[model samples]
Target chain A: GAGVSQSPRYKVAKRGQDVALRCDPISGHVSLFWYQQALGQGPEFLTYFQNEAQLDKSGLPSDRFFAERPEGSVSTLKIQRTQQEDSAVYLCASSFDRSSYEQYFGPGTRLTVT
Target chain B: AQSVTQLDSHVSVSEGTPVLLRCNYSSSYSPSLFWYVQHPNKGLQLLLKYTSAATLVKGINGFEAEFKKSETSFHLTKPSAHMSDAAEYFCVVRGPYSGGYNKLIFGAGTRLAVHP
Candidate 1:
């Protein structure tokens, strides 16, 4: 009955620092997605995974953004050389199947780069 | 490419009055539309979805939206506004994903303010 959960609800990082955001998808969920929400703006897609496979990373803003889900249940989004532009709310969502449109979201981790 | 547009950036309504949040979408194929609500410092919650089922879809908290293919609109509406209804509302469209998965494209969102 638990929903998707993310760790470190808030994170502050210095410029050029590397930060990692974690997401724990709902148990048995086959699809996981990450999104970025800038202030006063809508969320933008970042990446997606099906099981342990990183199927889509086209939405990732830059090469510095890397994501992995080795075990297929917990996924992490790592940003290398963090920049001020990287500041935003990182959101994680999971769905029952790949095609299912209904996604449950986590509270999100707000990252601030200074 | 599929995209969604939330016409209004903000809407204010008095308690017990009607509420309307307009949304229009563009897609190459049949679209799956959804409405999500976000409270401050909280996760997004699903209000309702239109997956090519009924034209009018009802969601949680007495909210509903009518899917109109001709107008390319899926506008959310409620007969009465409650104090708790104040929040940010998003209209999302699912992009065509050939890999058995679809990407969600969200509108800028509409901020709803309820007044007493």
Candidate 2:
């Protein structure tokens, strides 16, 4: 069985540009989440998805952040007008169900805004 | 609301010695506690989880944690430290969120270093 996976393990972007991070959750996972990890800090929640619906986006720092999981299996987090403060590791996780406690995580995409 | 605190920013121990990583949590409801390990350039791996099934939870790689509601603690421990154990450990708590889903809140994390 395969675990969650993320693409572009590392990304370097210039300020004012837009960047997109991809996440492939385990097959049949009913819940998906995104988090951000800054240097020497714990991961902070960003957004969540249940099936094809974006259930929560309150954690998104600003309107510049957008996420989509149209098909319900894969997700993408897009940041518009990237800023230095947005530089961090973007982590994606998935669970068997919304009630399940165990969340399998991906390797994450480390974004650097220069 | 739920939050976790890793008592120590870092802990260093010699190989073969006992290891302890302390964590405390605050939550409005019954919390689901977990310990996750992260190696350099790797994904977060679940070490163990406490979902009220047991007070003492055993996880992979001979690691375990005890959930104490009175102390509000779920500390991770290993009988003997191994050099391979050097990495970052996080204490996480899952609590109710909007839409009937649980949100995971993580601690700042503890960096453990094992020296031989």
Candidate 3:
């Protein structure tokens, strides 16, 4: 029984650098969500996917953020021209069916922009 | 617009004492409420959820919450506080999604501290 997995538990990048965070959802999970959590704050939604289609991305902060799930099972969140305010923990979650509301989360990738 | 409000930013209790974490929500319609916990350096773990099945929902670790439509409240409570119970708790509300998708709206969160 495997849960969601995120790559590079921790990453440090320069303010203007580009960074990519990867997420592997549970096998066969049809729903995937990405969120950003700042220090001492609750997680805010970033984007979501159903299979290979990008369903919603209204939560992405700005144009610097981009996400893709081309294969339907794995998703990636990329930040270009990263800024200091972009530092936070990126979380990924997956659920068995789109109809089911419960979501299981991964450990998350902590990104620090210096 | 749907949002959750955790009344207290932090709650401290002595071991063996009762624990209470308050949450209030606002939604256009009946919403599914959830409680999630996160330990230090760990990911979020679901404690329980209210999916309109029952007004009073029971969760893991002997915790429970009663949904009050009148008060718009879903406060979490436990019989007693344990050291292991100290963690950050988030109150979440599930939002209706398009194309049969479901999304969660999260609260700011409440930090719990247990002292022996």
Task: Please name the candidate that would achieve the greatest DockQ relative to the true structure.
Answer: 2
For each candidate, the alpha-carbon lDDT, in order, equals 0.96, 0.95, 0.95
Q: Pick the candidate with the highest lDDT.
A: 1
Compose the digit string of candidate 1's lDDT tens values, residues A28-92: 99999999999989999999999999999999999999999999999999999999999999999
Poorly placed runs, candidate 1 (over 4 Å): none
- Please report, as a residue range, the 10-residue window in candidate 1 chain A with the lowest summed lDDT: A96-105
The candidates' DockQ values read 0.88, 0.89, 0.82
Model 3, A10-101: lDDT tens per residue? 99999999999999999999999999999989999999899999989999999999999999999999999999999999999999998989
Can you list the residue pairs that collide in candidate 3?
A: none
Q: After superposition, how far is residue A83 of candidate 2 from its true place, in Å?
A: 0.4
lDDT tens digits, residue span B11-102, model 1: 99999999999999999989899999999989999999999999999999999999999999999999999999999999999888757798
i-RMS for every candidate: 0.6, 0.7, 0.8
CAPRI-style class, candidate 1: high
Clash tally, candidates in order: 0, 0, 0
Clashing pairs in 2: none
